[model samples]
Target chain A: MKRKFLRRVVSGLLVLSVVAAAFTGCGSASASENSSKDSDSASYRTLDEIKESGTINIGVFSDKSPFGYVDENGDYAGYDVYLAEQIGKDLGVKINYVSTEAANRIEYLQTGKVDIILANFTVTEERAQEVDFANPYMNVALGVVSPENAVVTSLDDLKDDDEVIVISGTTAETYLTKNYPNIKLQKYDAYAEAKTAFENGNGVAWANDNTEVIAFANENPGYKVGIASLGEQDTIAPAVTKGNETLLKWLNEELETLGSQQFFHKDYEETLLDTYGADYEETLVVEGTK
Target chain B: MDFNVINEYIPLYKNALLLTLKIGWQGILVSLFIGLIGSAILYFRIKILKTFIGIYIEIFRNTPLLVQLFFIYFALPKIGIVLSAEVCGTLGLGLLGGAYMIETIRSGLESIPVIQRESAASLGLNEMQSLWHVILPQAISVSVPGLLANVIFLLKETSVFSTISLMDLMFTAKDLIGMYAKTIEALFLLVVFYLIMLLPISILGTILERRMRYGQFGD
Candidate 1:
């Protein structure tokens, strides 16, 4: 009798789990169907629509510091946030900041989840093919950092067994994998974990955006950005959906107008001065005058 | 419904599934050891050890597993003790799983009739001998189902290790999504992988429970 009762309970659990999995499976099936339909429809907001609605959804990173991050009070505050706020003001719309990660930025734009991406989106040919990019706002390149005692100044300095820390999906990972396939990589999904892994001595060097490593070395003592630049120079720009021509045109004009007023320099002074100091002010900030 | 992308990534998924199983099994073994020791301490009601165990269980049980993992993998490095991501993830899962196991096993011990202990005492069995020879066997028989269920729960919980960069199954799926931007395909594959791992374990648990019940009740 006891055995019978136990068997019944087990079977019941099995049925319930199967039912749950089926429900989730069906849900995802429909979501994918919808995403494919959305891609065909090109259903994204225009400048007039956004202005009429009085709101623009801008995607920014909530975890990446200096570029974008949540402040101590749990509000979004960063260089990208400052720039996004300006775009909202110039467009005469209230800002609705949508938190996005590095990997999801393109998807967010494609799905109409956000009208613009300002999350330190580095311009690459592959990404540009999928989305429309406005004029560049800042310049960035990959850098490597390590402990001050055992600095890694270049890829050549790394030993065969040494592992380099990289955040998955970032340009650093792609650059190293394609260019320097000899070096081993320990990939982390998030910036915080990658930093921690580096601190734990799990890897010999941490490679990421030059601005990020500079900020990290400044924040954490005993670390230094030994290799300040390691890849092709790239520009960070605002990206719109594939066919968002009106919004893209507006952004380009806005950037050109902002350049006359030195808007980017003011933005840096307000959001990034403390972390990067004056040394990088001229090199990193782009006026977009052209 | 572009399953072709998923099919292309099957080899990567398979490798990730193996890593997930490896980490899950290691966590299970470590948790079982911790659970047995913890439950035994509680069953005997040791003086100071009980209080320490009580606090330990409460802290681990109440806090989120991700926070514990992050603390171990990230925060501990500041104090000079640094462990690999795999070790930190496994240790985190073991500690958390052990806390729940202790309570589940304790409840199993409570369900056993008081007369069994009294009879053992009268039959020349000392406290330790009675616990070992009589009480533990019965308690374990009763607790097999709960323990197995916990094992299944811990298996799923191992996905959280991906946050600490352990390259488990979830991390592989995330990597695929990051690469291809195919959210649904990657998520669907992840669910399928988890089901493949979990279903057999649940079925085995049921089998074990039925056998134990039949052995105990003589039906």
Candidate 2:
């Protein structure tokens, strides 16, 4: 009798667990559908709406150094972060830094998680379809970094066994997969992991933004930026959710206004000068859009 | 929501599912081997090896698998112990699952009545023979359910293989979502593929558990 009761209780628990799993699975699917429907109507806070809240959430990469990264003081401090602060000041609102990875930048905007993305976000025609890009703030292109011993000077130099390390969702990954389909690419989700993997010799070389690889080679000894530029030159810009006309317009005007003062140049000198030096200042910094 | 995208992703998902299963089964086999050995050490009350196995269990059980994988893949290479991502994933899953398996099998071993050992000895069996013919069979039968649960658990834990860049199912799903932004379709297919992998094992586990509960196997 006791054994039978035990079996019954066990079966009951299993059934309950199965039902719970089914419910959770359906629940999430429906929830995401609802979110997508809501997004279709444009679920972004406008400029005045952001001011009304007194705080604007700006997504930035806490790991991408010199562009968007946390400083030694635990505060967000970088080229893009400096721009974010100025935008916050101009809008008369506080800035809430939301650390984001490259893969989730569009999702963050579409989900109403951030008012702006300033994490060295490169503007491409494809990305523009999902998020509205503001005027250019910086210039960037893909670059490869490798150890001093076996530097990857060109894509053809990579042999069959040579794997190139790339951070997922970056333009570098897209470019390589498109252009060099035969190259074996080891993709990491985070910048830090890719850097670590590269350092550990997991891959023959690392490909990323020219600014990033150049900065990495400069900062870390025994590494060199061998293919200083791989793809077409692209401009970095702040992004807002699609259909966020008010916020998008405000950002463009603000960037143009800042251009008069050479704000991004100042941002470069203050935040990126240490990593990139004065020689790259003019070439890397874009003072608003043409 | 997007059937077309799901249809498009089936081939990629198929390849990723195979990789996941390959790593999952390899890890399970390693854990089973480790668990049996560790539990046997404790069963026989081996002096130094028992203490070592006990510490191994405690350390692996206490730490998260992600940290372990990171250490093996990234940190260990700093100290001249380099492991590939695939090796690190299999080893991490095996080590973590082995810890739980050791405890599970130990409980089953201890649950064997003392008289069972004595009866085997009285029947002219030596210590090893008694353990081999009597104690282990009963203990393993009692342990089928727990072992199956651990197998399922280790399989689920393969989701973390993406962190080390192993190209598992979760990695494929995340990569698809990242590349296309077809979040709904990617996630829907992810759920379906996981169900395909896990549901059969789950149902089989239930049947095995029922059989063991009624003592049908040993008899």
Candidate 3:
């Protein structure tokens, strides 16, 4: 009798838990559908719509510097942030900067949390399926860095037994997985922890955009960017939610005009040149409008 | 879009889950050893070891595991104490679990009536034999439940080690989410994975505690 009662109780609890998980699943689906319906048809509000609304939500990284970072004074300051300020001025709309990570860039735009992601967002074919991308403002190279002793000079040199460390969601993860399928990968989500792991010999090398590689190699004397450039030229571009043709057109047009003025090249010289030194200016610079 | 893709990724996820359990099991063994040995130290009231134990317990108990993990992962490597993520994770848990077990078992030891010890002394048993034969046997019943709960907590925390490339379940889930941008599916599955690991031990701990509560040990 006691065994039967306990069985019933256990079965009842299992049923309750299944129902609870089902309820949560439904809740999330409804939430996702609600967000899609609310934002999909609303689409691009255009420059006039933004000026009328009085603010443009510009998403940028709060950690990456010379691109987007929180300054010592708690103000958002970076090359992209400087451009955001100018864009706001030209449109006569207030700019509301939203801090975003590489992982959340597409989702931020898709859900209408931000009008655009300018957070050093490297353009990739996989990401393009979800968001509309503007003309490239800058060209980025892929690079790998390792401890001074275990330098990874090229993809060819890395042994099959070795694992490459990566910040998941970055262009590097996509490139490495596609290009070096046999090379094992030890992935981390956050920059800080990944850096710590790399320093502690968690992996043979760390791969990321060349800009980030340069930053790490310069800051940490014990490490070097042994593979200075890994793949074909990759571009960093502004992006908005897919199907937002009006916004994409405006951005592309502005980018063309910005290219003629050599605005992005100048932006790189002023902000990135000092961090990178003068050697990279002509080689790495890509002035707006791909 | 392809749910079938999960089949391809299953090996990675399964490997990660197994690693987590392995690390958790090792941590539990270390915790058991530490608890047993620490209780002996405290029960015997050793000279300097008691003082050191007090300090160690207070320090670990007062601080956060996240801070401890950061220190072990980063600071140790700085001073040339290089260890892999898996080793660093197990050692960190062992150290923290030892400190926690010290306090837990101390309480269980104290709860044992002194009358039994006095009677044992009269029966010509030395202090060491008295503690071994009398105190510990009874205390193990009480200690098992807390240690089991601690094991569960340690299992969950193995996820943090994933941040340092420990290849645990949470780490795999994060990797998949990053790869596919399928946040909801990955996160829900991770919670289910954790529940599966923790629930059986929790039920076993409860059963053990109840059995210990029967007439002979109840008083």
Note the DockQ of each predicted structure: 0.39, 0.27, 0.35
**Candidate 1: residue A177 lDDT (0-100):** 78
- Tens-digit lDDT track for model 1 on A25-111? 776765675566443455578888889999999999898888899999999999999889889888888999998866678788877
Give the C-alpha miss distance for residue B86 in model 3, angstroms: 0.8
TM-score of chain A of 2: 0.87
Per residue, candidate 1 scores C-alpha lDDT tens digits across B1-219 of 466877987788898888888878888888888888888899889989999989999999999988999899888888988887778877998898889888888888888899999999999999899988888888888999889988988888887877787777888777666655666678777877777788778766767887888767864
Please give the range of 10 consecutive residues that has the lowest summed lDDT in model 3 chain A: A37-46
Cα lDDT tens digits, model 2, A112-173, are 99999998899888788778999998899999999998888999988999999988888998
Task: Pick the lDDT winner.
Answer: 2
Task: Report the number of the highest-DockQ candidate.
Answer: 1
Task: Estimate TM-scores for all models.
Answer: 0.87, 0.91, 0.86
Order of candidates by lDDT, top first?
Answer: 2, 1, 3
How does the DockQ of candidate 1 come out?
Answer: 0.39
Q: iRMS of every model, one decimal?
A: 4.4, 5.2, 4.0
Stretches of candidate 2 off by over 4 Å are: A1-42, B213-219
**Native-interface RMSD of candidate 1:** 4.4
Task: Assess the local accuracy of residue B185 in candidate 2 as a C-alpha lDDT between 0 and 100.
Answer: 73
